[model samples]
Target: MHAKADQRIRVTLTLNGRERSGYAEPRTQLCDFLRHELGATGTHVGCEHGVCGACTVRVDGRASRSCLMLAVQAEGRRLDTVESLAGEEGLSDLQQAFRRHHALQCGFCTAGILMSCEEFLSRVADPSEALVRDMLSGHLCRCTGYTGMVQAVLEVARSRRLATGPDSQQENNDV
Candidate 1:
């Protein structure tokens, strides 16, 4: 039999610091491949049209909507999802902030929000409430009324700033 390309395409990428490969149809969304193929269910699938932000993930250090991208598009890229948020120490700083603030209700949108916040916090060590809101505009959370989320993100940012030292400019800027 002659070797020929089939409908399935092999995709290889770095997932949560680990190398992984999976085959998928060219039309398969990255969100689907992550969940069904790789078992990374932390990447939720909400609006397939990329409106709800539930499928948000970090591709190559930037926030991206997995549903909007095909699985093949993720080839050779580093992808970060909500699954990588936790460590041996337990909940990450952002997750701890969310838990302490009770920022989630149904929890459907928590993963995407956390991923977005993680990427934002990594880039912006100090963020004002306005800045946080602007950063979170893409995410849509029906639960917690958004106040708790804002508070949680602000707390994380403040704690990060405090960790830098007592003289951090972001100190006393608590939301």
Candidate 2:
């Protein structure tokens, strides 16, 4: 009989608007791959079993728990981490809104929360307070209650609507 050997899988994905390629074991979690292999430590790993949303990231514009997905499973997918929300021009609308609204505390859960909020706002521009609460139920934050986060999301939605007019709601759906 032959002995079992470690398997390395190659994956290519778009990360933070750039193309990234790497090789990892089939069992390697996406969170580890992003933080260790790719050095994208912005994706935190609070709970490895998907209980906490600290490892949240956008996979094809959908918020997903990186700890639950294998690195190989993200092959040929588009991934966006917290780092992508900022640039030379400064923070994106979501990042700015989080900061302006004081939605973060201890900063441990900020990245994941922002990622989830980004996804949520993209899907529903003007989400109700109840909807915001329900959407954020998947995440856990020990520092701040859901009040600040929900308010930040709503603020961003309102700003987008005001800046682009009511028709701007359609733009968020494409994200």
Candidate 3:
């Protein structure tokens, strides 16, 4: 149902390490809220039916399709968009790998692909090529044929695994 002015709900969430709050209609999609209200445009809305994975984002440290979630449902949750990965020094490790491997072409689907890979790499540090392909199965990319994308994610995961051994298996959940 559409929320009236008085019925508009308040949604507070932590985004990119910063606390942010916004008002939303009861039926407002999380994808719309992020792009329009929160200015986190990096989370793209592709098919809007959650098939393309273009609206992927990390909600409470897990990859989710923003298009399939309602804004009000995200209250009290921590959201991390693609914009959260950047730093003053330069791009994040995943982004760097994507660049080095030429993983992206038009870049429309790059954000979602990277986000999915982020969540995957967090849990699996030493993934195989088959596993990487399986991880990317949910995403659809017409350009680059996904070869570069898989390679980029693999590179990041391998390096991170080496840096953090069994004694220090810290997950990269600091999005």
- Return the top candidate by lDDT: 3
For candidate 2, lDDT tens digit of each residue in 1-175? 2222377777789999899988788788999999888999988999799988999999999999999998888999999999988889999888887777778878998899888888887788678999999989999998888788888898888887788788556545645
- Residues 14-86, model 1: lDDT tens digits: 9999999998887899999999999999889998998889899999878889999999889999999998999
Ranking by lDDT: 3, 1, 2
Q: Between candidates 1 and 2, which one is better according to TM-score? A: 2
Q: Tell me, what's the RMSD of every candidate?
A: 4.9, 2.7, 2.5
Q: TM-scores across all candidates? A: 0.90, 0.93, 0.92
Residue 38 of model 1: what lDDT? 92
The superposed Cα distance between candidate 2 and the true structure at residue 24, in angstroms, equals 0.6
| Candidate 2 Cα lDDT to native | 0.86
Rank by TM-score (best first): 2, 3, 1
TM-score of 1: 0.90
Give RMSD (Å) of candidate 1 vs. truth: 4.9
CA lDDT of each candidate? 0.87, 0.86, 0.88
| Regions more than 4 Å wrong, model 2 | 1-5
